[model samples]
Target: MSDVTANEVTIRQYRPEDVKYLMEYAEENEWDLSMYDHLAYTRIDPNYLIVAADKDDVPVGFCGVSQNAPDTIYFGNFIVRKDLRKRGIGRLLWKAMLEKAGDQNIVLDGGPEMADWYITHGFPYQAYKVQFYAVKVNDEMKQNIMFKYDTKTLMESMWPDLMKYDSQVYTNFDRTRLLRAWFTGDDVRVAVAMEAGKIVGYGSIHRKPNGEYGLRNIFGDNEDVIEALLHNMLSVLPEGTVVHFMMPEDKPLPKYIQHSMKVEETAVRMFNKVKIETNNEKIWFATAHTV
Candidate 1:
């Protein structure tokens, strides 16, 4: 165990062996650890995970930041143990992360309760709204839903339509990387909804390494098409598999999902800006963490 004075915490790159301690901290805070697993975290570039430890050589907190570009860094998960709160460990971790991040703009998804914290720390409130939902998948339902779209074949043929619709929804028009990552990456499945020979909606399912599944970037102008795509994905997964989704708060999709799945979880989208420039429009939905 490495020792540091109680007045200061030691921050360092995360080692693979640190997973046990990270999981313990997450459990203590009631935060879900299913999204991150050995494979996913290991696959991430080593420079991303930053850890803060106390004099006793115990991890008090940690943060994961993804450097998408030379000018931008996206925060993934930032947390401290419940019992260690208000001890300045979290602030130390944040400061260390920002220093390592250099001049890049840092962004994160946080809850409403933490807004004041960020505001006090020098980040402006840019936007605030999102909803999370979970549903159990079953085999019988999977067999009943029709699989009308082939993701691979469409990837080759529908590039034009896909790019057009994607730009309409996102603030920025760079879906090329995201599209490739979701459709071509391992453990990810993409499906589209079609009616009368036209693409109406699409959905992608990414099964994380820890047996948990996430519904990513589902979109459609038609409500029925979105429902169909969701139902198809749910059916293909194993019975009782829990699926989670995040969508805009004002969008009708959340209410529709709640009515269909009977389960809901709410989380706010908070932001802290290293550079301050106010925008007139609120960011209702984020295209990717990089944005």
Candidate 2:
């Protein structure tokens, strides 16, 4: 274990050259780091990512905050060397990252173990955990539940209404840049529920490193729309694929989905300044880092 002193730790903006060290740290600590996530964060303004380096200029920790929207910034990628905890390295990285956002509201998706520490820094927990659920997509599920609602591929022109719907559910932070990147990614597949030519729900599946699919930002006004969006997403994929989604603990899960889905994981979603309202029923999934 490395005994990194407070004075020896330095927090600064991340650079492209630091990825190799970050990847090694992530692998060493069993963090769920992926190339897609790294690429997405890199695409953002470089100033949003802050790295904590030891006296030798080796990366020991990192924290990222995305202020794509004017009034809000979402903090993520918060990690420090396991042996370096309780030494204020995380605090230094966090405080520096927070400074990048100025007065914008800061939102964080943290773990229960670190919830109290974050609250002490002014970001309070919302009294719930983000529930992660996963299920194997077999032929029977596709046949029985996926054929109920109609859906179509989402387009760039529809971003206006989509943004409105998202704003209503998420309550803060516009995902314009982030959604644009997601919808435009070659490996990402997006589907929207359509009723009388109006979109009622939307869902997107991102290709994972292991060849499975990961659901991102699945939300709808009703079960039909939500199911339709899911069906549209799965219809294009091969059979026997595994899909994973994360939802708020309070969000209602259908009996069939609940039966088919297992609790895969959990994380605490916290925010500073004020709590944001979300439609628990409408939200079926959230991204791990971008929330």
TM-score of each: 0.75, 0.85
Clashes of 2: 0
Candidate No. with top TM-score: 2
lDDT of 2 by residue, 115-189 (tens): 888888888646357877776776655674544557777777777878887887777556778777556567677
lDDT of 1 by residue, 25-132 (tens): 765554434433323433444567888877655676788876544555667658876766777878788887778777667777676677677778766755545666
Q: Which RMSD values do the candidates have, in order? A: 4.8, 2.8
For model 2, what is the error of residue 217's alpha carbon versus the real structure, in angstroms, after optimal superposition? 1.0
Clashes in model 1: which pairs?
123-273, 142-235
The global C-alpha lDDT for each of the candidates, from Candidate 1 onward, is 0.59, 0.73
Residue 82 CA displacement from its true place in model 1, Å = 1.9
Which runs of model 2 end up more than 4 angstroms from their true locations?
1-3, 20-33, 125-128, 142-148, 171-173, 259-264
Clashing pairs in 2: none
Model 2, residue 27: C-alpha shift (Å): 5.6
